[model samples]
Target: MTLLTVRRDGEIAVVTLDNPPVNAISEAVRKGLYEMVGHLDADPEVKAVVLICAGRTFLAGADVSEFGKPPVEPHLPDVVDRIEAAEKPWVAAIHGAALGGGFEIAMGCRFRVAVESAKVGLPEVTLGVIPGASGTVRTPRLAGVEAAVDLVTGGRPMSAGRALKTGLIDAVVSDLESDAVAFARKALGADLPVPASKRPLDQMPEEFWQAALKSASKAGHQAPLRALDSLRFATENGFAEAMAHERETFLDLRGSEEAAALRHVFFAERAAPKPAALKGVEPRPFRTVGVIGGGTMGAGIAGACREAGMEIILIERDAEAVARGLDNMGKIFDGAVKRGKLTQEGRAERMAGVRGSTDYAELAQVDLVIEAVFEEIGVKRAVFAALGRVCRSDAVLATNTSYLDPRAIAEGLPNPERFIGLHFFSPAHIMKLLEIVPTPDTAPDVLATGFALGRALNKVPVRAGICEGFIGNRILKRYRAEAEALVIQGVPIAEIDAAMRDYGFRMGPFEAQDLGGLDIAFLQREGARAAGQEVPETLGDTLVRAGRKGQKTAGGWYDYAEGDRTPQPSAAVTELLAGWTAGSLDLPRTEIAERLVGAMAAEGQAILDEGIAQTPQDIDLVEVHGYGFPRWKGGPMFATGAS
Candidate 1:
């Protein structure tokens, strides 16, 4: 009498979704759910049903492989409808993440219980779809419309505490399966749990909703606006009517080229760097590490090492510099504690693993050493040369250089094979990317160790071959050059930034430059120009000459008023660019934006063609992780189909 393992205790039955990994909602899973629900509804012995999945996660989401294909018979939506309309009480026991269609399926149940560590979200907007399976309609009913708007628009997952506060689930259980079964049995004897369909629509005070919409509009991202519209429909109409509207919107969005491109990017990121080289290569165990230099990058590297549970020795040129680095590190730990991300005890424990010193002899026994010193080639080469003489022969010597060639830095080292590049992004502990650059003489074991260290640091390790600026910076150089060209052609910096922001970048090139500082790019431009390379005419030079460095000085390409971070167009900058281009071609602002996109995409394509990047996905991952490129639009190459 068992369709897929029917086990009943008294009047309650447990129906498990026996799918592996994320328990993605596939056709077979849908059919199994429908058949099991029907069996439970008809059985006299079973008065209630508890639906749960057998895995770390309840349901990760839809099977991405099944997207864009014709619907299989008895689709997941139909199966969910059957469960929702069932006469018997049904409880959903969730652990891990319940997202997209998975969350919708949970909403269909009469009751929901989740573990304290469980996470839930709709997140369909990330894949360019509104939650088509009634999630857009139901989530707002549980959490208010504003919360729903934030979650669906941002595609952020919430913790069990947040879920409980929002009324998304009935209870947060210590033991998901047992507690869910008990809840189901108790519900069968008592009244049915409040059905999602019966819940009142979320109502915000008129002023709040108006303000929320206005804020979302100011964000200027399309997905947020679309998510807001879906929530609006749900509030105005009933659940069923809103669901119908959601379906239409989903279909329209799914057919868009942008959506297809975004989806392509999603899969490409997963396939970015092949693990083939990592096969059969075992990583070295790193219990302690030495970090040279006490600047921002060094402090960030020390924070990352300590965060990974590795004991660290922070080395600086002098005692005072070392004290400053340790102080900065403490500030970072304090901020983490204040944000509730770390307990006081946890922060203390992490900080305890880090020590400061000014002596080179202190690094003799560490497993690895990362040089985060100044970007000068001579300084880095000298550091490696000294490290080679002082450290163990097998110790991995890494240079945290953004653009300098690793092979050149390793030239005079005694053991060049152990030297490589570990380019950690700014605020290394926070950013997710670590570009692992290997020179021709770099040992396979060293590469393996760098990759392992990246995983240990909870970073996405990408293998990049040695180039002038490696992968991310190499492509970024082109994009920056294009922005400068557009400026020379008479486009306002503010307008160019706005267009890129509308296209889904977190910030425009000029905005990023202003925040990062105009002086930062001056050295790189000078280097390029000194090498007889044609320099793109950038308004950055004009600003730098005028002593308007950036936000630190309150002026660059844009002006920042006192106590304000918002950038306003600088008349001085506009006049400089206008005077420079007065005798040249006058280009429209829109054309400048279009050219910027074209140049970036073209440069990305050229990188792939030249074998600098392994695949189009690799380029995308570099942009997404290294830069603040928007994930929803995919990478530059993915957007342009340059791959």
Candidate 2:
């Protein structure tokens, strides 16, 4: 593809990487870069080299397509080394994102300059590996040890402004090419800085390293800690030794189970937003959205749509309810302000775009309307009925019902083709998962519009066929069932939760249920029972019936102190459920995690077999993004090799 090409401007030579779509550092690009080092070093007329990318971003990272393949010649580390050893000093001109191998290559240059809005990072830890191409070794040499620790272990990009403050880049420029060229020209005569490989290393105390290690330890993922260890090793040893350690660590973890799981999730997430089936289909544009219901879910949905620059009409049954809905959305925006995510002015501006009303006529102008009312068939049907009469025939109608039949909800809608189910997780603005469910009658573009909205809202959209709970909750139902079965079989609830936490989940099933209130699911089951379905009783029903609804009631599967959220083993719960238990069996946490994950995967397999989900990856995404499945374990489907 002729990924690398050079052109001369006076005494400065510009090397542009032409690889399209992120310009990932592929083998061909690596070979070209390695050869160019010597070619540029030999050029008598080239006094300085300005390295930049042609498309949207500088080299984003190593080519993910090359992952798990046989190693090619001219490895990234050697190419970076060759760049550092070149006779002519190099200036990395960065824009968009320079991450992982890209950042390492930038480190190899004598100087790095970026546009003000550009970002740079070493994010290999996210994929279950440390950076392989002198990322750990050269980062601390370029920036300090503390900054290196944050860049490598935390696995998030730093803006160019922050990068300059941290000494990761020389300057933040306005016009990338010309400013970078002038930056290189000025640097040719100025006292040139030492190569990143030769820069003095920063040393930190043991306590500092211990704190860094603790901070880097996220759940049970190994990459973060290992990345920190590499940075620490760089501080302790010479550049060459640290480089070798980092490379060895990267190679060792690349074949590990955690890395493979992460890779599975990585590919799954990449393929989710735009599925292959809708390649040629174009979604209808929806700039104005109507959200019915002013409760928690509706407010969150409206806030999320508003954040995506969509005009929102938050409709409720009454004016008071509409006021409450606006307040609820205000609380969401207020929280963002508190977190420094939004300014008060920005929040006000966003809220200004949202118009609250009680009239269905207000929704007439909306391109789409999502109903987030009570999860009753009649209530939802009435909302849709009103929407059917007022909304445009071409308007996309979506239901945010978690468990009800979407097909039944859209029963008498005017245009059944425009009806779809968009099951957004609670705290919609914060949660990333959005299940895009298509009924049998849903048109392709309508389905595409749902996915399009999901993207606009910055969500991970998974296409799900109409089924009870769709993909996520269906698996969650089985997961909770398996946990209950464990409790019945003598596994301690606290012990089960502990095992899951060790396995990388932030909370176990019972603990999460207690936090979310056990009554929610219990009520769902009760609703199903009321519908004349053969719903069986579970341990949770017994708890809810006893008036333990969760944190609000200060009890559920466990007891809570006055205001403390810590779960204490409840004698009341034990006495209440003693009748359900068979005999006590002390099981290790690993076994408990394995059994639970296996159960979820088994349910996922059934879902796939029934064509409820398009692929195993979709199920995995559902669990990882919607439910609290540990990302490093991939999802139940990938973890259990059911994919």
Candidate 3:
């Protein structure tokens, strides 16, 4: 008697979308829902329908595989329309994540009920599209225009509480399906509930719209403005007109090179390699980790380990250094709590897992020891020698050296196969990328363990060969050197920065140099020079020599004043640069920017040619995550189509 299973209890009929994984809205699911809705509409027995999905998630989005293909006979939009026009009251039960088209489907229902842990968003922007199925129109009607604009444009997900506060959902339910059915039944028994389409538009004041536009402009770029405009069309016109506008804008934007590049980056990040050589190898479980040294890198690495639920032992040479490291870590956790990212209880729990020590013997029972001590070869070797004798034979030994040979560090270790490199970026917990370096002597299982640990810590681990600075920083050195040479050729640092920023870099080369501090690079260059390596004399050295050490010193390539972090071009630095290259041919600022891009692209290609990197996509991933390459334009390689 039921085309779709009608397991009715009282007045409620649970219409479950029986799809796997993230319940993607496929053609079959759409057809099934349409037929089920017809049966439910005719049956006087069922007064209300509860729409739910069976999977880890309610619904992820549209089936991406259907993209660019011929449309199915009955599209998901048509199915959503049928649900919206249904005579019986309906409630959507959301669990896990309801995103993109999935969210649109929920929007079409009379009301939505979400679990406490559920997340919701219209993340179509990330996939290079706008929500084509009334999402652009209805979301703004439910939530305010500004809220909808931010969510859709940023493509960021919101927690259940935030969604409820924004009125994206009617209620936060503990048992999503049961509560949804109860709500639907109650609504049916009371009075006919108003459909989402019949709901009056939540109009935005003209002043509010203007203010939002101003704020979005200050935030910079074109996407936010586009989102605002789309919402405006939805609010001003009707839903049908807004949908047509959404489709047109989506198609136009989707075909753009920028969108294509961004799509490439999205896939490229997911393609981050897990070596086949380490397959089926089990990682050793570690409950406790010991970090040798209490320097910035060491402390940051310790913080990252502690954040991942591992007990940490931070050992420094003296009590003062240990106190400073602990204080810094405390400040970091406090900042996290202030940002509302970590609750006080969570922060306390994470802090309790870490312990500081001065004795190396404390590492005796630790499962993994990461030596973030001084980058000196002898210092690392000596620490490894001591650890080899003291720690368990099965414990993995790791070094945090940026450009040192792991093989040389493990030379006298009891088991060289257990030693590897687990390079964490600065402010370790924040940066998502970890370069995992392995020597030939390192066992496959040890390498596998490093990758697994990285995953557990929510870091993308890339397999890197033993080289100077591995992949990211090594290529960065070349790119920065090229930018620096232009400064020596009478090109102003500000001009270079402006050019790169205009070219879609978040910050210009000299601006980034100023922000990162002139001292770090100056000190690094000195070390390279001392090692008989030819050090490139870039603008950084000139600024450092002039006592311009960046924002801390209130001057670098630019002058800074109190309460003003903005950079003002230094006249003296300009005079110095002009004198440094008196006979060199003067070039235009635009040309310098072009040259910088060329240099980055060329170096990326060279790295690929040398097999130093696995793919051009790997280089792109490094640039995007590690170097702050603009996400919308994708990574550098993909942006320029260098590969």
Candidate 4:
């Protein structure tokens, strides 16, 4: 039946929207609302109206499925207009999230009330479009220009408290729907009520708007700049003009290539939580976890577990190592506190959940054990053997290996079925990618537990079969090989990085290595060579041997000044490299970029071909989240049309 119902809450008529999950604004909902608002405006018996959604949240946003479709009977803006122009004043009750068009509908109401935990924003910029339903025009009026710029440009939701202070919401009460009814009754007492659409905001300095527009373009996203344009139009023109401009800009960006790519990733991320095989299987219990070693990777893993509210037993080689690891974990929490991401009290609570010890015996009580020691096969096997000796027989054992084989690490284990690989990218606590790798011998429940752990940690988990480097790194190897080959042939190193950046990556490969240190990739190459594996002979080994270990050392492929991380093409580096000049090897930037991305795409397809990954989405998730392949480009697979 109808998604909207008008019920009498005493003097106030409560219009409840009942769509399961987040009540997205659909065509049927709009048609129903348009007719109901007309009826309510005609009915003299109704004093005021209170609009609230049933279930956990208000309308989250527009129906995404409606995107790119022909316009329906009642557009969101027209529906909002009808609601606002009603004879009786309308009050909106907001809880959970009122985002994008959802927030726009709330803004259309004369007054709004919300629960303390409620959040609202125009987050359409995140999906690569400005608000099409006059959200941009009204936001600056509801809140001042500064607040509007902060909310729209950042595309972050504002808490109810902030919304109240910024004049976006009138009140925050304990009970949402009833408080909204009370708010509606109180609004009816006003001498004159004004709809939000007719409201005007004070003007800001031209520099403010100019700076916002500049930042939007510099940020490399089209929506924010267009959002600024809409706000500017609202400041200069009237409501109707500004709304028209906003809608036109929204439609333009909605059909843009960047928007299409971003939408692909938006849908991909939503569908990546569970793979096809683990759809019906229940994940094994994973409350407490044991993390072996206390180095950077180990401490990051422990920090992630602790942040997830899991009790952690962080084991190291000795008491000193344990202390160091504990210190590292504390530092990570301290950084979080400094960044306002965690309170001091919250950091203390998280730290309290973790215990530092040199004993493997402490792992007996944990539900899972993740070994995050040195990424050597011998070292990883030794750690697992110790875990096998001390851990519970049923506890899931996993390795944080990037390239090594999991089956080799699981060799001679007491319960080979319990062993799996959880290849977390560097800065493990912060990074989102968790490659949930399973050996052929790994049990279903155990593999599901790995995926569960990734979900609990708020990481993107991609199921991968045992292989040389798995999906991400295998593709990365090929990409890097191509990069080095390009540079060696004739492409300038800086030009190569800038080319990739132009393609929408945050940083190029050479730039990322400086921050992560070049030694690791060097070691990986040398290790592969010693093992009789075919390894590309890049300029990295020579650079490392010359004491150019990257950002930590202030130089690698690119030179850096003291305390500054900007990469300046190095003269010394150029002098050392033979045949790196224009005469030696030169190619078009596009050719280089295509070669890099194309190689990555081919390797990714090969991984799928070899049954190393279940689906293209899995490989795309690994590259996008783990490897920093541009999300707006929908990862390399989607970029290559392989997806």
Candidate 5:
């Protein structure tokens, strides 16, 4: 079937885009649109043109499948330009998502109407580019400079209501296509609003302009900064020149390292959740969930579930602990509201979905029960045993253990197939990564449920097989080990951190550990030792044992004096290391970084070799999203050539 078709209805021609899924502005669709526009313009029977789409969404964006390839004729820019220059007025009937180039096309229309649920924006910044094809130029002309900057740089689509308020759309309609047809007739019957390209920019205070530039600058991403510059250019230059600049900036940034890295993330995130075995399986449905702890991780997990509109029951040791856990969950949403991340109504709805319980029997009605208690094997097994008895036989029983063997934890359970690991990183509600660890005997649908939950909570899920630390922490262990090896070989901790920062890591290993608390690693080490497993010793353990538990305790790996957490070289640590008589090998910063990253890559290879992780990209994603491994480097696996 043709990608685009036009049907003339008396004085108005209704053009429909028939692309499946989100109608991507492909070469064929653009050519078809261009031809239809020319045909309708000369027919004389058509007074105005109505552009709408079929099958799910309107033009969502460009056909990303054509990236990094040879260019074809009738590019999106050319099509949108024709749209702007059309003699007959064009009306855009937007529904679902009209984002990136899709929104740009809508902006090219003379008057736009959309369904109430429609969303529109220039979201190119998220893919590491600015809106090409005059979106930056036209959006500012129609929506004013501030809204343009926000819509373009922020890369979030505005709902139809917000779009109407911002003047991005003419009206919010009930029947998208029919209303747009009526809108075209009514519009042609009156004095037309000027085309978006001809509209002037709104004047703003000097501080507002400065503030916009400052916000983009502070974002630390090149795409947003470029978007800000393009919007700013629209104010200073003519519409045509600013549109030229927009196309130029987009093409310039499209091949950039940052853009490439972001695209890698975009694609990797899209592919990460699916495992080979569960390819055809459907996830079991779930409503109410039971969380078996009210500590930080439990509260965060419960908060995330509540945020996903899932009913939650949090289990704690007693009434006071349950109250505290619920209190912590409340504080999280309260903070979200205070920060403008959540509306008061949203907070109230999420809070209302959550309740506290001291009884395991209260979990009988829950569809899924996750144990987010202390990451101890025995404690987790005991929780599962109780869960096995209380929860329905088919309900998923998940352990939130970071490193313990999930298979062993399910040993006592009657239905081992339902037991799996939903390893959420610390500050779980905010973090995006969720490692879905499934034991060998885990039911396919049960495994699918873990991924399903990750989606519900808006997290990136990677399926991992049974292993201590799964994918992220396993590789992180190697990175940490290598860092300690550097410190032991007479590399100053401060110099090591500086080298890693230069290598694009947000913070060096030691600094991150200190921030995460040194006590965490110490406890893990001691736990393994008590279980008769030989754990590699790190300098962090010694420091933790020395009452230097890091940031919370005012110091670890470095000094934090008074009100400063600046991480100065500690004389006490210097004395301790010097007294311990470590071996000397003065390594340069570059060499130190290479050896550390190499060690991590080696461990990642070992993980893949052992089938601990399903794919190299999975390993890369874990390091990138979970551990702050530089996205620009494309994860350790790609950077190290181990993928």
Candidate 6:
């Protein structure tokens, strides 16, 4: 298709880019921009150019399809540089997002104007690289050194209003095309602003640089700090020198393991919401949702659906339960208000849309109903049974069971095809991971609807086949087991936790269990043992039997002093598990990390072979999003290259 076309509006030539979807800066697009400069410069009739894009967005960023490939001719930096050097001035009219290389190209223009809703940023640090094409250099020149440091290092886009305040854009207009053309016409004879490359960068104090570097430094990640370094270098050196340094940093990180891992996750996340298997299937539309139970998980589900603009019908067993459910949901909105994510007025408006009831009959008209009641199979089945009786035959019913077999829960429910399992992580509104488990009788449309809900909720949905713990929990079980095995082998508990923290997890497996409470998993194992299954006792089970249930009890594997959450190794635990412990053995921290990750990967491969998980990337996504597997290392499967 035609990527570029120029139309004349008097003396102003409006140049439009027509790359569909996100209008990425591909090699052909780069060459087109490069050639368009010379073409526009030669025409004296074209006094100026208004750069805008067709389809969804302006230029979003560099073509990710070209990642890890050889460099093509007329590279992005050269194209942007050629645009800046053109005889005719250019005004960039942006909508949607101009990010990474896209924003770099915008900075190359004489002026930038965007719609009020448009956003712009240099988000290369998210992909494990610094902006190579003048982002670090030009940003500081356009804005200031501190702003550039925050923008480039944080890798989050700012709104057009914020960009205007930061001096990143010239104006925010309603009519993008006509206003941009008029803007170009007005500036034709006026003194144009100095080119970003030639503009002197704002200098910051040495102490500011030091603090910026420290703030940018993240565990097991290098790109943020490196991005800050580029911005610092631009202020201390010439523009060309800093640009070269930025390019070198980008190229160096492009081939690094962290970059590759981030790319793996990026692609996985992009492909997650809509799977290939559900490509042609149309999902059933859902607007009003019914959620059973008023506890943490149920309230979170209701809050998330409400946040997604769906009307929520929260159901509980009785009047008191319904009141508590609404209160739980109110707390969620309160937190949102506290965090400035939602205004008090907006919270009241959203909360007004929520209707709580004790009767399942209230769910008769809901397009979908998710049961987030107790985890027991009997309680879950009972909830679905009530839903089957009250809901429409076409209305979708979902269970939020973390470990129970979905097939078993839907056994007696009518219209099994419309029933599916949506295992949302705790605080479902906040967590991104949603395991979409489909039973054998689940309809394609129902399965598609699950993915659609995931998209609506802005979650990473990974389709999982029926298994005891599904994908994430199964791997988590293995991870915890591996950590326990290391402890049994006489490795210091604190040392193992330290090793995992070094490997980039926010908390070690044991420490995380302590905070979340050990009885959560212990009860699951107890249920299995009660069902006449041959289940071996775990270290956590031993602790639970001794009335030590983690931070809630002020002790578990470690001791918690009063309100303090920090875990101090318990001497009583050492004596309790003395029967299983071997002589003291000290292994390298690297080996401990390898064993844990290797164990998780091994479990992931087993899941893949058993058809519980669709792809290696799916497992990676589940671990990263659900269980706090350090995203920079990819997932366990990607890190080990297993399955």
Model 6 stretches with alpha carbons more than 4 Å out: none
lDDT of 3 by residue, 73-155 (tens): 57666777888898776788999999988998898888899999999998776765677677778888888777887888777
> By how many angstroms RMSD does model 1 differ from the true structure?
3.0
Q: Which stretches of candidate 3 lie over 4 Å from their true place?
A: 1-6, 67-73, 217-221, 273-279, 536-539, 542-546, 562-564, 582-592
lDDT of 5 by residue, 432-513 (tens): 9999988888888998999889889989998877777888888888888888878877788888898898787889998998
Worst 10 residues of 5 by lDDT: 576-585
Question: Would you estimate the TM-scores of all the predictions?
Answer: 0.91, 0.99, 0.92, 0.96, 0.94, 0.99
Candidate 4 Cα deviation (angstroms), residue 354: 1.0
Per-residue lDDT of 534 in model 1: 96
User: Which should have the higher lDDT, number 1 or number 6?
Assistant: 6
Model 5 lDDT, residue 173, Cα: 96
Decoy 5 TM-score against native: 0.94
| Comparison by TM-score, 4 against 6, better one | 6
lDDT, candidate 2, 360-455, per-residue tens: 999887899999999899999999999999999999999998999999999988989999999999999899999998999999999999989988
Quote the lDDT for 612 in model 1.
72
TM-score of 2: 0.99
lDDT scores of the candidates, listed in order: 0.81, 0.92, 0.79, 0.86, 0.85, 0.92
Better of 4 and 6 by lDDT: 6
RMSD, one per candidate, in order: 3.0, 1.0, 2.9, 1.8, 2.3, 0.9
After superposition, the stretches of candidate 1 with alpha carbons farther than 4 Å from their true spots are: 1-4, 218-220, 525-548, 558-580, 584-588
Q: Summarize candidate 6's per-residue lDDT along 19-98 as a digit string, tens digits.
A: 98999999999999999999999998999999999987889998989999988989888888998988999999999999
lDDT (tens digit, per residue) of candidate 1 on 476-572:
8788888877666656677788878867678899889889888877887777788798986566787787888889899887889999999998877
Question: Predictions ranked by TM-score, top down?
Answer: 6, 2, 4, 5, 3, 1
The TM-score of predicted model 6 comes to: 0.99
Q: Write the per-residue lDDT of candidate 4 for residues 398-483, one digit (tens) a residue.
A: 99999898888888999899889999887999999998888888899998898788889999888888788888888888888788
Give the RMSD in angstroms, all C-alphas superposed, for model 5: 2.3
